[model samples]
Target: MNSIVTLNDTNCPITTSLAIAEGVGNPHASVIKVIRQNIADFEEFGNIGFEIQNSISGAGRPTEYAILNEQQSALLLTYFRNNDTVKAFKKALIKAFFEMRDELNKRQAPAENLSRMDILQLAMQSEEERLRLEQEKLKLEHQIEEEAPRVAFAKQVEAAPDAISVAQAAKVIGTGQRRLFAFLRQIGWISRRNEPYQTKIESGYLDVKLGSWDHPDHGLKQSVTALVTGKGLSKLQKLWSERDQDHAA
Candidate 1:
């Protein structure tokens, strides 16, 4: 292991530099021997400006050193088989060493349980299921909204005027029975009747009056011509006829 190998200052740690070169998969007697050998070699090659190179072959010029053992005639290896960050550094150095030097043939690759395709398929399926559930939830929410108003109207109808029919109330309000009830409920003018047979309007005893069309407060105005025209004009015609009869008398 007293080989004259190139390394960088970052990877110059004795244990790490050795651990990387051998790709020690598991802590073994052989791995420890390699670490000790590299550390001894580095101490021997004191600052001769060793060339620094990258782990990858395509990487640029040597940024570090690979100072070998100058004093020791033979290198003694040190073992670093652990799971800590320090151990990880050693592992990376070993991987880089084997890759850069084309020494992978000497070691076995690490074990992996999941394949690339299996992981990809699982990710895609998870996304699809999520989208489908979201769409279904949106559909159910829409249905509930559409039926809300109709359900509210039906409840109002059940609690209508007891003495006066819904039609009578509609006539007083100058609107259809259903439309009038909907408007009453919408405006919060009524509530569910507590009495067994009483309607909401009867229970609340709300006034169903259509005030004068001529009143400004009512916000209704009849044109002068319309007031004296059509069926409305019949009352005026009788009054005029009575006036004519009185003049003849």
Candidate 2:
């Protein structure tokens, strides 16, 4: 195998070099000495002192360690610019850099590694499974369609209106007598007219505007605060914000 394949690149040579310098502790060290030390550190310890913080939250101590604040990090970046010894150390860490990065990633979210081809294969498998499910769904839909007419006819007779006879109410509702009675009774609209053609109408109970079917409101009406929370409240807040922005704009 090519040794270069196992090497890190020199993208952040300055930082790498400073790490070496910091570890070995010599401001005026030779480039080769710094490089050797950093490489030896990698070979021996498998990583620099940087610790990755664990992402998953539980009772465990954080998995990755953090080092250096903004000032220290900035200094490290600047050190790479004027320091040849640091550059050499960075060059030596190139191979291990990628491996270290992968390890850190796995520690954060473990999963099997996948090549491009492997990902493509899995995607294709998912597509095939989805298509199979769709075909089965379509076949089931066809079966439902074949049985629908008879089922509908039976239901229609059962649910036919019992309140006022449709023929008598036709003129008042501006529809045909037969059709009007059928419609009104099915919807539970009683006649206003009294017995012996009393023509008394019962009040309509269904609120069609709320939803598709005759679903009753059922309980006491409440304030908006009771209905919204978390994401729902967030969405309402966003809508109000957008409205305000529009007015401002």
Candidate 3:
């Protein structure tokens, strides 16, 4: 059997509803039901308390699972009226989680020290080299700004397309694909495996056109892309600008 609690690469202790059920000797379905009933409580605790994630089953079907952090795990355990064995497990779990967290912090201390030393070394660099590096960094920033579609199309409202792919939108918005997708999900613009930017179109936030294209692998795909209209472009420009402003603030 897999360990009920495992530390992620980042040293964060994480467990799932399944693991919690197993650890506490409860039915997984019962555990899931209780969590759903108290979903608001979990959400109030934010991402650290609980996160919904999709996983593949042994039968190759997708399943949704709740990934719980240590705090969430402890809270969940409290919901169950358990015997001595489960109570002991709960106590042990909490203790182990904190111990692991402390161990990780200790392990990271040397790396932090090395980072400080590196920063001091950089501070001692020759003035000319430092100036050159600063100039290069600024040049790179300028290039990135220039290349971003949002920056280029901000003033031209009439030239926007009807429907754009998530990849294209991310490029235009000057955000990573994954980051943009996550943001869109958070805003309820899209869900798992749903069309990108569809909610925006449905909500009249933007207009879109469905189109097909020849695929390099599959012969041809239909409705595989959405072209953003001129109006959509304007909306996107405003949204992206506001996002940038928020980040700057």
Question: Which one is best on TM-score?
Answer: 3
lDDT agreement with native, every candidate: 0.38, 0.35, 0.60
**How well does model 3 score by local distance difference test?**
0.60
TM-scores, in order shown? 0.20, 0.21, 0.41
The lowest-lDDT stretch of 10 consecutive residues in candidate 2 is 194-203
lDDT of 2 at 81: 55
Model 3 spans with C-alpha error above 4 angstroms: 8-10, 48-57, 60-62, 111-249
Cα-based RMSD of the predictions, in order? 35.6, 27.7, 15.2
The better candidate by lDDT, 2 or 3, is 3
Model 1, global lDDT: 0.38
Q: How close is candidate 1 to the true structure, as a TM-score?
A: 0.20
Error of 2 at 143 (Å): 4.6
Of the candidates shown, which would achieve the greatest lDDT relative to the real structure? Answer: 3
lDDT of 2 at 38: 47
Ranking by lDDT: 3, 1, 2
- Stretches off by above 4 angstroms in model 2 are 1-111, 114-117, 139-146, 153-249
